[model samples]
Every structure is written in C-alpha cells, then in structure tokens.
Target: MQRWERRLSDAAHALTNCGETYFEPDLFRRNVNQFLTIIRTVTFLIAKDKANIPDYEKWLSSAIGKYWSGDEVMLWAKESRNYIEKEGDLELFSSLSVALVYSYFTENDASIEIGRSELLSGGIKKLMRLAEAELPHGVSAAAAVKIERRWVANTLPNYELLQSMIYVYSRYRQACADLAEYLGIILSTTIPTAESIGEGEVHQRRVSYVKFSDKASYSKLTHRVEIDRTITPPIWLKDVDRTRPNFEVYAEMAERTFLHFGNHLAMVFVFSENGTILQHLAFTPFDQVDKFIFWRDLAERILYLRAESLIFVSESWVRKDPGLLTPIAQAEILGEMLHVHEIKRTGEVSHKAWDIERVGDQVSLAINDNDSLEASGFPNYLVPIREAFTRIHKR
Candidate 1:
C-alpha cells in the first residue's frame, strides 16, 4: 500500500507537469486519458473487492518504515487505533476511512499525507456541515468547488481510506461532465425550421401539440355536442386556461384538445415559431385527459427544454412529417410527440442553399417555394439549420 501511495504521488506530479514538460498536445491528451482510465479502474476494483477489508496494518507499518521515518506514522497509527476502538468494526470503518483518504490523494496529490490525517481526525463529519452551506446565486461552479474542497479537507488525513473516496469522487465527476456535454450539444445547435412557415422574429414561445386517434375512449356524440368540433380538443378542456398563455397553458391545451376525440395517446411538440401551425395551436384536442400531468412536466424541466431554442415533437406527428422535417425539428418533436422519422424520396430537399454540397436521402422540407425569399434574403437562422441538416443527415 505504501509503495502504491508513493507511485500514485509520483504519477500525480508527473501528470500535473506533463503539458509543460512534454510540450505536446497529443501527449497531454494521452496522459490525461490514461490517468482518468487508471482512476476509474482502481475505483471499480476497490468497490468490487476490497471495500470491506480491515486497515492494511502490515502494509501501513512497512510504508511508514519505508517513507515516513518520523513521528507522523506514529501519530497516524495512534489515531487509527482510536478509530477502530470507537467504530467496533475494524474492517469496515478502516476501509471506509481509507477510501476517503484515497479520494483526496487522487484529486490533490501535493497534500496526500495531510489529507490522510484529516480523514482520521473526524474532519469528514464536516461533510454535513459543508453540505448545509448556503450557495450563492449563479455560482454553481464555485459552490461545487467549495464543497469538494471542504470534503477533501475533511477526508485527507487517513491514508488507508483513499481508494474508496477516489471511486466515489471519480463517479461524480464523470456524471457531471456527461450532463454538461449533453447540455452543450443542445444549446449550441441551431433552431429547427418548420415547413410552410414564413420566417418571423425569434420569441420565447411556449408551444405544444397533441394527437387524436379514432380508437379514443371518449364518445363521438359527447365530443361533438359538449365540445366545439372545430377545436379538436382534449377530453379535459375545462381544466386549461389558454387566455393566460404560458407553457402550462400550452400543455393543458394539448391535453384538453385531444382527450375525448377517440385518441388513444397524445404527443406534444412546442417551440418558438410563427405560421399557420403556431396560429392554429389554440384548436388542438385529445381524449381522456388527466389533470395530474407527469410526462409533460418532466419534459419541460429537461436541459434542452430550457435552452434558448428547443423544439418538442410528438410521436404521431413524426410519422406524418417524415422525410420533410429537419434534425432540430425531429429531435425536439419526434419520439416525445411522435415516433422517429422514416426516410422516403432521395434529394427531395437540397443542401446547396446551406453551403453543404453533400447529396443523399436526408429528411428535410422542400425549400423550392421559398427560393424567391432566399433570393430576396432570408434570416441567418435558416442558414445554420439548413447547413446542420445537410451535415448531420448525410449518413
């Protein structure tokens, strides 16, 4: 264990200076990749095998002799003895303590020895205290750093506990990175254009759509007599107030419009767009509308939904709009509102206008009628959407 600790400390120092020492981007990337891979592998191994073991007493003694050569090892041993006495289970408590220590070492190798001592000295109990700290507005990154700092400060004292802590910290870091990447992809992409709609000013419009099926549960007579036939409405139309006009209203409108019209399911798509579809959103409907809306609420809270420009699509709509819809439109609206797109005719939509020359059966709306508008000059938003569709769909 002591040899491993020394190796880890040496590796950390090497990694920290790799870019400066090597002066190579590829080497830097490779080193970081290797470090991350090793961290992950060690974490998995400890979690799966050694997490329940007692402190490595023999290993610690050998490490102290080989490395410490001072009173530091004696103090650590005394603290470990006290911890074992209080916990009543040497194996479990020591293992957990050692895990916490390893986490600190991996993150901050310079303070590895001090970090080990902190873990043994009841510093880790401060996790709850730090967790209770108030976070400032719009300072999530800072807050996260603070929390990690406090956690590391509290856990760094115990050398034996380092492995387990490393495992947990690595998992958390990976999860956060994954989430950030997903959000980046969504926010950085261009907004999708709707078919047959004229380009209009970009507004944060809350939009949604619902599907009605012939196999709907509600009776036709009830739908026709009680509800306005023109307004293909949901079964629970009375619950929504479209006058206030917000995301909640849009969601309710979809449910109320589709509930009683023999529709088995309802898929909703919403985005900021102007044209006949946006204008006609008021009259859509469904059958069997439940007031306690779960899926819609969940969808609204997703990262993509909160993005500056996001499109929501229903599965039923995707089937109808297949081969003509752009990727943004498909991503936002399909599956949630409708199923995935099924490709049809090849080269029905041209990529030339978008600065893309690739030709294939990519699904995109025909811009033939709008060529005159293009000649007259369309908005810049359309250009990116067209280019993205061409680049993305050419597989």
Candidate 2:
C-alpha cells in the first residue's frame, strides 16, 4: 500500500479498536486520540504527495475547503488531536444513566442520572433502591431495566464519543476517497461498510426481573446484581446469557411483544413474510396485575412494526366474555388498519373465526370466517395452535 493508503487503513483500524475499548476507559481514551491523529495524518500524507500529482497545493487546499472548512465536527477533530499532542490527553465526560422499564411509564418519565465515578466506586447495589424510591405512585420496581455508560468529549458534550468518532471517520473516509479519485489511484483496501459504523450506539446493558415473583425472590435477585459500571449497555430481559438460544428468542419476543391468549399454548409465533417466523414468544399467562401490560405492549409492537396481518389464537370465551372484550378493543384502536384473523378455539379444536379489518376510513371487527384457518390462506398460522392443543390433550 502507498503512504496515503496506509494512513487511511491506520485510521480505520483505530476506529475499529476505539469501538471495542469502550468498556476500558483508559484504553478507550487512548484509542480515540490515536484515531484522531491518524485521520489528520491521512490529509498530511496527501499534502506531502504533491510532487507526484499536478497542482498539488491548489487541489489539496480546495479539498480541505470542501470537506473540513467551516465544519464544526471536522474542526473539533483537528483541534482535539492538537490538544492531545501538545497539551495532554483529551478530556472527556463520563456518565451512567439508569432507565426503568415499567408498563405504567409514559413519555413524561425520565431516567435516573448517576455519575460515572459514583457508579463505579460502589453504586451497583443501590440500583434497586434508587429505582424504587423514584417510582411513581403505586409503582414498585421496574419489570425490566436498562443501564448505559457513555463518554463524550468535554468540549462537544452534545455527541457521545462513539457517535462523534463515527462521524469524523465517515468524513475522513469520504475525503480520502475523493483525493484518491483525483490522483487516479485505485485503492486495494476496501473501506468499512455503513453497518459497522452505524453500530456505535451499542454501549449499554439490560436486566429484567421475573413477573409476579414474591418480594423475597425479587429482593434476593436484586442483592446479587452487579454492574461492571464501565463506560458502556441493552434491551430489557432477565439475567440470562445472551449467547443462549432461549435468551435470544426471549429477547426478540420481549422487543416485539409477541403474544398468545392462554398459558397452555405451546408456541406463539409472529410471521414477517413468506411464512418465516419473526418471533416465537413464550405463552406465559399474565396475572390480574399485568394483564393490561400484554395488550398495551402488543399493540405498541404492532404499530411499531407496521404489521398488516394478525392471527389471534384465542379461546371461544374471549369473544363472548365481557371481561376479555376490553383488551381486544384496546388492541383494535391502537393497532389500526390491521387485517385481524381471530381463530376461535373450542375444547379440543378450533372452529370458524372472524376477520377484523379497516373499511375505507373506519376500522371494524366483523364476524366473517366461514371456513377453518386452513381454507382461509392461513394454514401456517393454524399449525402451532393445533400442535398446542394436541400436546395438552396428550397430557
């Protein structure tokens, strides 16, 4: 590789290393400074290569004007490197933020703010108590919680260090590409993909408590909680190894709010397209305290995913029973413009069902299924429900 290419590769390597070292504060700080220095070196190499290329000074000056001139982010990157080399290591602000995930929380809720030093020193044990004290009226601890540790440049406090670094890396990558094109030099080394750079936000952790657990079990679980408290984060779920298949499925289900009517159901699956199951949720029955949670979460997920079809495997009682009717209505309102297929279940078999759908301007749930799910273009949806019923009968 040429001198300019080598400098560009070094900058990329520094960025890759910077992302991996967020958990190690000292190393992370060093990597950021190295990344900044390498970025500056890329342009410096271009300036020195002027003898080989025509009008080197004019082209380099114009390129700088086009890329880095008047750009605050790029200017900051240059200044940060100068500060590190001349004065000292770049100063950074580190912080830890704790967010409690409860069904009752609305948009008005705010996450608890804790200093990095306080959390790292010995604040992990206080998480539960801190969370409970600020919980709203009648609310205890969260069903799930998210904790994030972030670092930002003390000068540019608006952007997290990773985000700022990613932005600067992308800018420099473009500048280098333009310079190479101008010099008619073909790069042998491939640039990093957009997805790799976009993953800069994954600096957090998550922990969830079991639903409907007794106080003793909850307290015991809380006492054993340990936060590495490093400058790092995740979605809400129990203390399960994410590498495990079951935990992956559980996390996806929690994120998607995949649901089923009864606890006895063997599996609850959400399909995206072509019968591919997006999520296979555990059919855990909600008690009285959290029954509303399931419907609300499910509705929110439906809206978020912009899902068009919904096949609900529900017992016959859910339709005629007054107590079960409210949640169904809530689902309809929140999940508007949805084509709903309600498969009514009897003792051992599912009967005909109804199709609730949008009509012109308004949405309606009308009884319309004259045949079984197998005949209604939804044979795949019926398979799991039948399998669950088969298992229950065998028991």
- List ranges where model 1 is wrong by over 4 Å: 1-239, 243-245, 262-395
Query: If scored against the real structure, what TM-score would every candidate get?
Result: 0.16, 0.46
Query: How does model 2 fare in lDDT?
Result: 0.51
Q: Which candidate gets the maximum lDDT versus the true structure?
A: 2
Worst ten in a row by lDDT for model 2: 216-225
Q: Clash totals for all models, in order?
A: 58, 5
Q: Each prediction's Cα lDDT score?
A: 0.27, 0.51
Give a tens-digit lDDT track for model 1, residues 1-395: 32222333333433343323232435543443344333333323323433342443443343223322433323333344455446532332211121111111123211211245346334333422332343222221111111121111122343322222222222223222232243342211121111111111110011111111121122111011122558754446665666663444543443333333322242323232121111111112332121112222222222111112222222233223323222222334332121111111121221111111113633222212333333634322223333322322241
Q: What TM-score, to 2 decimals, does candidate 1 have?
A: 0.16
lDDT of 2 by residue, 146-227 (tens): 3456788887886577767776776666567657778787664466632244334343221222332232211111111223
